[model samples]
Target chain A: MKNLARYIITRLLLTIPMVFILLSIVFVVLRVMPGDPVSSMLGGHAPERVIEQKKEELGLNRPLSIQYLDYLWQICRLDLGESMVFKQRVTKAIAEKLPATIELTIFGILITLFLGVFLGAYAADRRRTVQDYVIRLYGIVVYCIPVYWMGLMLQLIFGIWLDILPISGRTSPRVFASTFEKTGLYIIDTILVRDFSALGDVLIHLVLPAFTLGLVLSGIFVRLTRANMLDVLRADYIIAAEARGIRHKKIVYKHALKNAFIPILTMMGLQIALLMAGAVLTETTFSWPGMGRLLLERIYLRDYPTIQGVIIMIALIVAMASLVVDIIYAIVDPRVRY
Target chain B: MATILEIEDLSVHFPIHIGTVRAVEDVSLNLEEGEVMGLVGESGCGKTTLGFSILRLLRPPGRIVKGRILYHGQDIVQMSEKEILSLRGRKIAMIFQDPLTSLNPLFRIDQQFIETLLTHEKGLHKRAAFTRAGNMLESLGISPERLLEYPHQMSGGMRQRIMIGMGLILSPDLLIADEPTTSLDVIVEAQFLDLLNDLRKQFNLTIILITHNLGNVAQLADRITVMYGGTIAEVGEANAIFDNPLHPYTQGLLSSIPNIKLDKPKLKTMPGSPPDLVNPPSGCVFHPRCPYAKDICKVQKPETFSKDGRLVSCWLYG
Candidate 1:
């Protein structure tokens, strides 16, 4: 337990430098990009003097080193500065939009795990059969399809032709207007307010985007899970378990799957970054009111603070997620020491 | 003593893309109750496959193609999945060659032992199962407290002892040990054999000890069965087989054992590697390497002949 705590602390400390590097990169990339907030905001038709005045007011006219240090200092104090596009603090904008993205991501991960793990294990258990081949093909084909393309295809099918689900937006306007927002996450707020119909509405709106993001990424998991399951199934202990007369289900799920899960868990941590990347495309495609959509709009409007802030938040989350995975790995696998 | 196991015309084959690898072929053997049978063979000679087949635990691609494994008059080959599940830990158990790999690393020692006990004894409480496992471990000279530790925490010898304890906890009628001490050091191997012998007597276990080590067989086996190229070469009482190995293959195996008593010992190795199961030699499997190979040995497979109250499969026996 003590070792785990120390490990977590060390892991967390290590992320600081990683975040710093990412922040520096974001800072450099945003600065070196061709667009200026003042010109982009004014549609590039404003007089030079007016643009210069606006740039001065925004502190962009300062020296590069000074601006960089100032940006870092502001971030150190937990201030992400005001978004040129939203006319609000970048931190507040992110906090508002983050919960929706998080909700979508949570659902996406759940779906990914459900589809990937079970299908993968099924394929492994029934290896060399028709089902295994089908699943293997599914894993490969799904991963090959681009996330945005899949989202559009799903939208076309489920939204237009089927017309069963809403293709765009998070919730129906009626539910959005009536439900009192408490947590910023529409699903939870609906549940907390005891609004079942509103909850249904929110979920109905969520299915297309979340599924789009989840299905595309689940392919990696399926392949990973199947490969790991095959390896674990061949382990001597699995044979030993069979020899002990343990039921086939227990051996497959408990013994083989448990061992296979360590590597899968590690992969899952890495997948968070991929999931976040996928969320950006899914959110923009669906016009869902989430961080990804917000980041896209801000980038178009040359909202430097908002873009840098969103990327920094994502990098931190990815780092923290991997750390959590390492801790869980150590807990689950006895051989893993600090 | 009653016949505890009867394997009649057993043939285990692994069919791959190229061809079927005949791992065990038409080998007939029976075990008397409370007897230790040493199954000796070179690597890839089907000794381990035979051991696994008794429990009907051969994985995919490797299967019992033609055979009847009768455990106390019940055909294991025909047993349903549920029936076999019940028969496995309750009636027959197995210990593998590498103890480290045989035990699940994630589970504590007690969990592995208790799982076996609980699997066979359905109504047994978890606490009672733990107590039983701890007692079993104590008998094997392992501390009961160490049951909480993972398999990796223990040394190879200790882990092997735990495996033995688990195999016996259900008091199975037959125990198949496949190269159980192959992974242990020399000193540990000696200690393990002694422990196994004492346990065999105490529990009256009927074990099929599979190994290439003739020395281990010499220590504990009452009856010895020598296998070569997926076929049984010879079977007889340990003392008789040791004193006068009838089959040429047996003679070569016995001579290959280094005699330390000689002033300058010459270690004799068999001329060629064990035959590939995928493309085994046609006639007598051992004839290619047999010192006294003849034209008949190349064309016709030898038949098992009863001579002096023992079975020898060689043209020479004819």
Candidate 2:
């Protein structure tokens, strides 16, 4: 317990500087870009008084160093400022949308983990056989198909053709009133109160979009698992395990699969970040109303606060994903620990 | 005496795109209960191939065309994969040649040993598994604390000892020690051999000691088989093979062993390389390098003949 505490503290301390460096780079790069945030907000034909007022309001009239210090101060104070388009606090907007994006990413990742490792190992265990070829084909086919194309195809077939699931939006309007009254994240409060009907509604709404997102990411996991599991199976220790009269399934799962997880685990955090990047396409198509689709909308209106806010959030997420991955890697493989 | 493992006419051949390469050909040997048999040959002489074939680990390309690997009178080639796996650690086990490669370096010794134990003994919880693993390590002359150390943390000698201990932990009826101590230093090698000698007696283990070191073969193996060009050139008691080797290849191999005797002449190497498996010599594979080669020797292959209770495949014996 003490060791774990110390380890977490070390990780947290290390992450502070890393996050600062990332934020500094993002701030500098955005500043050097060929546009004035003030002018971009106001139309070019805006009166000079309006422009001056906008510049003063945004605190853009200060020196570069003072602006950076001011940005750092806002960040330290947790005052992310207000969104240009929504006219709401950036943090409030993100907090409202963050849950939806997280829910999608988590469901997608869980599906990928369960199916990818299972199929990869199964294929490796039966190398050069028909099953191996079939799984390899599946991996290749899914990997080659872009997520956007696949998401549309799924919506067409499953939503339009079958009508078994919701075509767009996060939840059904019928149940949205009675079932989930609190947080818009219908899945959680439903499960928290053991409301099966509400839970089913949430799940019914979740499957198509989550499955679409998961199906895309699972290809990478399957290939990684197949490659890593095959390598581990060839290791002498696995042969030794088999020689010891261990059942074949145990050898594949416990011996081969666990050893294969180091590589898989390293990719998992990256996959979370990738899923967020991918969610934009998914949300736009599905009309899920997550930050991804919202960000896209802000991009069109040239909403500086919303655009910069979303980008900063995305950067923070990517950085945090990597930090979490490194920490987990150290935990799982003690050899990697400092 | 009951034979623990017997391989008859076991041949492993690899069919290439262009030609078929024979790796182990027409080789036969037997290991009695508690007997240590040494298989001595140069690299690529099919020693390890023979070991893997017994385990039925030969994947594609290298097919066992005609062979009968009879472990206690049951043909292993006919056994299903599950049956073979059942026999692997319970009845037969193999210690790989390179200790570094044998162990998965990513795992700690305790994790690997415990996993090995749990694989054989079902439902053995982690505590019991750890206890057994630690005890096995201690029995192999390793300190129990070394169980926590990773494979990299241990010395070559320690790793080799751990490998032997892994093979012995199951107390299999037959243990195939394939060049068990080949990668260690001379002193470590001798210590490792001695450790194996002690463990074999303790567990009544039937061992097949595979190596190219004639000196170690002489000290360790109860019986010896001299392999050349993927076939057994000579098979006999170690003393008999060392003293009265009948085949020319065996004679050449013995003559090449350097003796440190003060008055004796220095050793000499055999002439020419081993016969290529892809295109082996038609008649006697060793005829090109044989000092007593004749017109018949180049045209006619040698036949196995029994002499003094040992098998020798040489025209001179014929």
Candidate 3:
């Protein structure tokens, strides 16, 4: 327990400097860009007096060092300043959009975990056979595909041609208000409200986008799971297990898969962070109102603080995911706590 | 003697990128019930392969080509997957050389023991399995509390003892101990051997002790089978093998050991290595290595001859 506490403290302390460094980079890059936030946001039609007033309000009139320091201080207090694009607090804007990206990733990772491990075990068991070859080929094909193109194709087939699923957005505008009452997550909020019809509509909209993202991600899981499972299956303990008259299913699932899962879990956190980044392209293709799509919009409006806020938020999430992975790794193996 | 396992014309071949290596050749041996049989050979001579084939534990790329491992008159090679699954570790258990690698690194001693029990005997409760596992460990000199400890937490000798505990937990009919004491120190090795002897008698276990050390074999084995280049060179009572080894390969192996009984000027050593299985010598596999190799020994494979309850596969013996 002492070791675990020590490990957690050390990780959290280390993450502080890393997050600061990433934020500093995002801050400087946004400011150093060709355009100024006030000018780009107000546009040429705005009067010079209005632009000056807007610059003062946003603290652009302050010296560059002071502005940077003020920005850092606000961020330290969990404040992301204001979004010129949304005319609201950057953090609030982010909070509103975050749930969608998370919802997509939750589905993606679930699919990845389920398929990665299952197919991986199947491939290892049927190694060098025709089934193994076909799985390998399938994994390769899925891994190399452009997720955006896959999403469009899914939308084309399931949404337009078949007309079975929703092509875009979180839910129908009529049902969206009902989902907003409980949790920000549409599916959960729908359940909380007992709005079964709205829940069905939300799920219908989610299917194509989630399927596209999940399928693309599943390829990596398949390869990683297969490779690790193969290695673990060859381990002496596995041989020992086989010699002990342990049924094949028990040996593979209980012994081999559990051991193999460690490496996959270690990689999962980093992949989740990457998935957040990937949601940019995925959300754009499907027109989902997630943080990635919001960030794109703020970038067009040259809303510097919101862009900086979004990047910092992503970095924070990545750091938190890494911490979660470390905690999970310690839980699974215990040795990592030391 | 009542026969327990009869391995007839058993051959195991491993296919590599270059060619197939005939790891275990046409070898026939009979194992009697509750006897300690020593299978001795140098490294890469397929002694391990032969031991594994007994339990059908041999993995792929290496497979039994032509064989009948008759366990109580039932050919194990011909047994279905289900039959073999039920046989291994329940009917016949195996203990490997390096105990550290042999036990799962990730699992606790109790977890391994309990899981092994529950795997073979379904509907066995976890608590019941755990109790059985703890009792088994306590009997083996490991405290029941230590059952929760991982395999790495224990010493090599302790781990080996734990392995032994696991092997005996189900009361298997046969035990294939492949160099079970090779990793331990001399002191630990002696203690482990003694424990094995005691356990064998207690369980009435039929143990096939596969090893290269003649000393270990002499201490435990009642009968001996000396393998060379994937074939049995000699098979006889342990006393006859040590007293008057017939085959050139057996004789060479016996001489190579530094006999402290007589103060030898220097330790004797075999001149050439074991033959390559891909393309062994045209006649006898041991011809090149055998000092007694004659013209006929280089051209035609020798036939086995039985004399006075001993079998020797050599032209010189003929």
Candidate 4:
């Protein structure tokens, strides 16, 4: 236990430098790009003297080294600065939008986990059969199709054609108007406030966007899980389990799947990072009030602080997730240690 | 002695894209209760396949094409999945070749043992099963406390002993040990064999010890069955077969064992490799490699001829 704790601490400490590097890269890339906040803010029609004065007020007219150090120091103090576009604190905007993105990501991960593991195991169990071939085809086809196109198709089918589900936004206007916002996550807030009807409304609105995101990612998982399962099923221990008179179901799940899951768990951490990237397009297509949509809007408005802030948040999350996975891996596989 | 296992015309084949690899073809053998039978063969000569087939554990693309594996009058080949499950571990257990790979790496030793016990012995409490496993481990010279450790924590010999304990925990009527000590060092292998022998006597286990190393079974097996190219080359009493190997293949195998007594022994290897089961040599499978091969040996397969209460499959016997 002590060793494990030490391992976790060491792993966590290592991520600090990683985050620093990522922050530096984000800082450099944002500055190196062919645009400045002042010109974009003034619609490129402002006088040179007025633009220079605006740049001076925003501290952009300072030396590059001074600006970089100031930016780092501000981030050290947990201040993301004010967004040029919203004229609000970047941190506050992120706080407001992060929960929605997180909720969508959670649902996307759950759906991906369910579809990937189940279908992958099923295909492996019936390898070389018609079912296996069909699943393989599904994995390829789903992965090949663009995420936005799929989202649009799903909206057209479920939203316009059937008119059974909402095509845009996170909640119906009536529910959004009545439900008191607590966490900015409608599902959680509705449950906390004991509003089952609102909860259903939130979920119904969530289905299309989350499914579109999840279905695209599930393809990678299916292939990963199936390949891992095939290898695990062929292991000598699997044969030993069968020889021990253990039931087929128990052997497949307890023995084979447990071993197969380690690799899948590692893959999951990577997919979460990918999920955040996918959420940008997903949120844009649905006009969902999430970090991705917020980031897109800020990018269009050249809100450098907000863009850098969101990317930093995402990088930190990806790092933390990978650390958690590594710790879990050490726990599950005895051979692995610090 | 009562016949515990009788395999009649058993043929296990692995069908691939090229052709069917006849791993075990037209093989017949019988085992007496409380007897240790040594199944000797080269690599890919179907000895391991025959061992796996007894419990019907042959994974696909390898399957029993035609056979009747009768255990105490019940045909294992004809049994349903449920019946086979009941028979396995409870009635017949197997210990695979590589101890490292045979045990699940993630599970603790006790969990592996407890699961096997709980699977066959229904209504058995987990605690009781755990205790039983600990006892089995104790008897095998392993500390009961070590049961909590994973397979990787233990040495190769220790893991192999745990496998043996697991196989015997259910007190199965038959145990198939396929190259059980192949992965152990020389000293560990000898210790493992001794432990196995002691346990066999204690449990009155009927073991089919499969190995290419003739020396491994020399002291343990009462009867010896020599196989070559997916067919039985000879079967006889261990002492008789060792003293006078009837079949040319058996003679070659016996001579190949290095005699340490000679200061500089001239070890003679067979001229060619084991036949490819995908397309085995016609007539006698051993004809191409057999130094005494004749025209008849090339054209017609030899029949099993009994000589002095021994079965020898060679045209020379005719």
List native contact recovery per candidate, as a fraction of 1.
0.88, 0.46, 0.74, 0.88
Write one digit per residue (lDDT tens) for candidate 2, span A65-159: 99888777877786777865456888888887877887887888888888888899899888989999999889888878787888899889989
lDDT of 2 by residue, B1-318 (tens): 898888998989999987988999888888788888999888888888888888887756788999799998999999997788778777888887778777776678998788777767878899988888889988888899889988878888888888777777777878887787778889998988888889888998888888988888988889998888888888899998888888888888888877777456666899899889998888888788899887777887788889999998888878
Ranking by TM-score: 1, 4, 3, 2
Tens-digit per-residue lDDT, B167-212, candidate 1: 8898887889999999999999999999988988898889999999
Query: Candidate 3 chain A vs. true chain A: TM-score?
Result: 0.93
User: Could you give candidate 4's per-residue lDDT for residues B227-250 as a string of tens digits?
Assistant: 999999999999999999999999
Per-candidate clashes come to 0, 0, 0, 0
On lDDT, the stronger of 2 and 3 is 3
Kindly report the TM-score of the first chain in candidate 2.
0.87
Q: In candidate 1, how many Å is residue B35 off?
A: 0.6
Cα lDDT computed for each candidate against the true fold: 0.91, 0.81, 0.87, 0.91
TM-score of chain B of 3: 0.97
The lowest-lDDT stretch of 10 consecutive residues in candidate 1 chain B is B257-266
Model 1: DockQ score: 0.88
Q: Candidate 1: misplaced stretches above 4 Å?
A: none
- The TM-score measured for candidate 1 stands at 0.98
Quality of candidate 2's docking, in CAPRI categories?
A: acceptable
Candidate 3 residue pairs in clash (backbone atoms < 3 Å): none
| Candidate 3 C-alpha lDDT tens digits along A38-66 | 77777778998998898888778889899
What's the residue-level lDDT of A20 in candidate 2?
Answer: 68
